[model samples]
Target: MSSVSTRASFTAPALALVINAFVWGTSWWPFRQLEARGLHPLWATVLIYAVAVLVILALRPRALGQLLRTPVLWILVLASGTTNAAFNWAVTLGDVVRVVLLFYLMPLWAVLLARLVLREPLTHHAAARVLLALAGAAVVLWPAGRSGWEALPLPRTLPDWLGVLGGFCFALNNVMLRREAHRPEEARALAMFVGGMAVAGTLALVLVGNGMASPPPAPAPGWVAGVAAMALLFLAGNLALQYGAARLPANVTSVVMLTEILFASISALALGGGHLDGQLLGGGALILAAALLSTLSGADAH
Candidate 1:
């Protein structure tokens, strides 16, 4: 009976992981469409997340109450917010492969943050994986064959930095999530979704304040339709991710996150007018391998 129940418990999380993959895999299309229609990614991010937060509030009012009672939840909000904003903005403006590879650097950041924040002592194997990940990133970001040390090698574009920053923020988010694993899953889910809105709104305000874009338009009728659809998708994705991550071990969950890159890459290739480039594919493979190995290493050590 215990064996049967254990197996049964895994089903929901496995299904949730699949749904989360599909949502992220196909997300680039809607982002592009919204961008073409003159709603920039940042605008769409704020619109979608705000609506999702409202949905969460309506469905689980208690989640907000939980958040209010705990200061740690607010920290999660900040971490999650920065992560979502950085990812949304980076993917919109950069090469899908390049951005995704950079974002996978989360494992390196995760390991370091885990050591400091969670006090999970880093093993030598983990340290090696981090170095390999960094080397892989350097190879990709190194300007087309200008590998000399004096080149001050860096990602030569704004989107590259955003992608890396997003990954770092995601690492912080994951660390906080792990540290606060004792919290109710509902509260964590609320923090993830609401924190995303907070980040997007703050960034949008900064951009507008600095004259980065024109003022937003007054609400429109179709805007309602768009926001509704966007919110539903965002809420579904967030819930699926939370559900899946909660059921799986940390290493398994980390491995599952790799699906986003696959989904993003394949969708970008098929529908987002992206092409597979050798430098990107090579770099991406290394980064993904490092992330997988890091998790596997930890699991093996245990």
Candidate 2:
């Protein structure tokens, strides 16, 4: 590529990454709206991701061939799928601020998963990053007025647990991306979108079968339109992620993705959908600081 072309490729991918973060940051609102229309978040997730998957397969039939030839892509499917299912469900059940902060703990998980899966050495910086994240999580999860190491802090609600678990899956998803970096881009994108459908659809079926969630009602034109729009946005964001992750360093992508926390926090608070008290602020700072650490070296190798 020419010098100007090279620069555009780099900058454009980074911008696309930021766009992905922004879309995810603001996505909770639509999930909540769909829930109000009797479409449980899980069901909505299934529908939205199903649509995205159909669109992808229709446009890139060759991507399916790429995926079937790549076994690792199946794991990618599971990781990315569970990440979406857990996060979408958790956001509907928990405060958006709390859920988002928990989810952004991805840096902590990324570092550890990298060390394990990629055999990256644990440096002092990475160790400190882990400690800071742990302390921050403790501070955030510790209930108000309950202080002084009274007990090991634990996630208190369904959303809280789901958020943390989803963060772990997200970290795994990213690690797999790095692991499979040499794969066809269409294949990688196909894995995530298809995973979104398979995982969420399976979970939705189980929940509805057990009466824990209602079967999706006849589509209200209003919510169906909203679901269609959000599905398109998610499809775009996934494409952006593939573009950005391919062009940028993995660590840089992780750090830029942290902007989702800021976007979610501000939007949730402004909309009266979430609270922002002292502990959350302090804890979120520490967690984000750990993520920021990775960007300093501009490398969190897979």
Candidate 3:
């Protein structure tokens, strides 16, 4: 009975994690398609998030009032918004493997920011995990680095930089979320979703207004079908994340979410859409190991 109960305990979150990973992993392909069809990824984000926001509003109009009443929630909005927008935009613009790996650097960010934001003490185990994760990031993005002062002890590629920055921001975002964990989970999820839309929309406006990118063109005939699918997936993914996040420790959740990198990397490789070189492979192992350690370490803490 104990064995059976132990197995059952892991079932739901495992399934949710897998589904979320698959959604995020394959998201890049459709985003690229939309880009090819003249719909910028930012605009694509806007479309999906708009649907999510509307759904949330329809279900809970009071959430809006709740959001407005809390300044801390606004801070949450900014953090989550930057995380989602920067991560999405960066992945679409960079190497899938690099972007995903860099984003997983959240463990490092979470540890440091946890100390500052949540007043959580940094255990030796957590500190070790942070260093391991950072080493892995450096290995993965090694190909992007160059010579002289230009070489800042990291990858030399522009996409690699974008991915690293995205990961750092992601870490900060999650730390902030955990700091505000006392808030209602539903409210947090709503803020994250709405914040994602606001951030993406604002960036899009700036980029277009500044003539950095062209305006979003009318999508092809089948665009609506794709958009619908994406919207449903986004809503489902967000819901799963919100639910799982509320139930689990942030460290554990971060580890579970690392499954997204595996899902994306394997799919990309299988589809001949991406490559796995030595640095990326080695770096990925380190990152995975670190995340797993972090999760397992936190398992008994709560």
Candidate 4:
């Protein structure tokens, strides 16, 4: 009986983490679907997060006050908002697998951000992990039949740039969360949700003014349903992440979250949003290896 109880406790949180991973992994599909209906991803991000923010406010009305009191939380808001906006737009326009791989370069950015923001030491292990992840990124970026300078490991397209930007912001977001971990959890959550709405909403307006992007289309049942469902899904995923991460070791949480890559890859391929080749496979392995190593290093530090 004791053994069974212990097993259940561990399994439940792990499963919750998986649920979070699955939501993000397959999120590209719904985003693409909304885009097809003439809803720009930036606008979609605004609506989805707006609903999520309302839900959070309803449940934790005081969270907004706490979030506003801490000025640093505003940085968290900006980082989290850019992370979502860039990622959602990138996945909608670019090859899903490539964009996701680039975004997973979070470990590379995390090392640098931690040093800068948290004043954490740049340990030898962290440096090596950064190099490994960079190497992987080079592999992914090297154009076929190109060599030397022509094969520069640079982002080649809008989506590629967005992917890298999102990853950088994501690393910063994580660092801020760690730096401010002493704050109330609800306040942190509220900050992130509000950031999503504020940043995306502002960007959408700017783009619409410039005619670079279209305004949200008139109300339709199909898109209305899609946006609502996506909002619920994101909210659920966030809750699951909080639950699982609280109960599990940091290393375990990191490893489980990496499954988002697998889910994204498979869904993209199946849905005709991405393709695979030798270069992508090899590069992805190196990136994931670096991420895994970073998780282990984090565990050691703890």
TM-score for every candidate vs. truth?
Answer: 0.89, 0.91, 0.89, 0.97
TM-score of 1: 0.89
lDDT per residue (tens digit) for residues 41-72 in model 2: 98888889889878878998899999999998
User: Relative to the true structure, how large is the alpha-carbon lDDT of every model?
Assistant: 0.77, 0.86, 0.76, 0.92
Top-down TM-score ranking: 4, 2, 3, 1
Candidate 3 backbone collisions, by pair = 144-155, 144-156, 144-157, 145-155, 145-156
Q: Name every residue pair that clashes in candidate 2.
A: none
> How close to the true structure is residue 38 of candidate 3, measured as C-alpha lDDT?
78
lDDT of 3 by residue, 102-196 (tens): 77776777677777877788898888888899888767756454766655557566566666666676666666665676876667768878888
Report the backbone clash tally of model 4: 0
Candidate 1 lDDT by residue in tens digits, 216-279:
5666655556667877977787778878876887677666766888888888887653567777
lDDT string for model 4 (1-302, tens) is 99999999889999999999999989999999999999999999999999998988999999989987899999999999999999999999999999999999999999998888888899998988899999999999988777888778899899999999999999989988898989999999989989889998999999999989999999999999999999999999998998999998898889888999999999999999899999999999999999999888872221
Per model, how many backbone clashes are there?
Answer: 0, 0, 5, 0
Candidate 4 lDDT for residue 53: 89
Q: Model 4's lDDT to the true fold?
A: 0.92
What RMSD, rounded to one decimal, does every model reach? Answer: 2.9, 2.7, 2.7, 1.6
Q: What is the lDDT of candidate 2?
A: 0.86
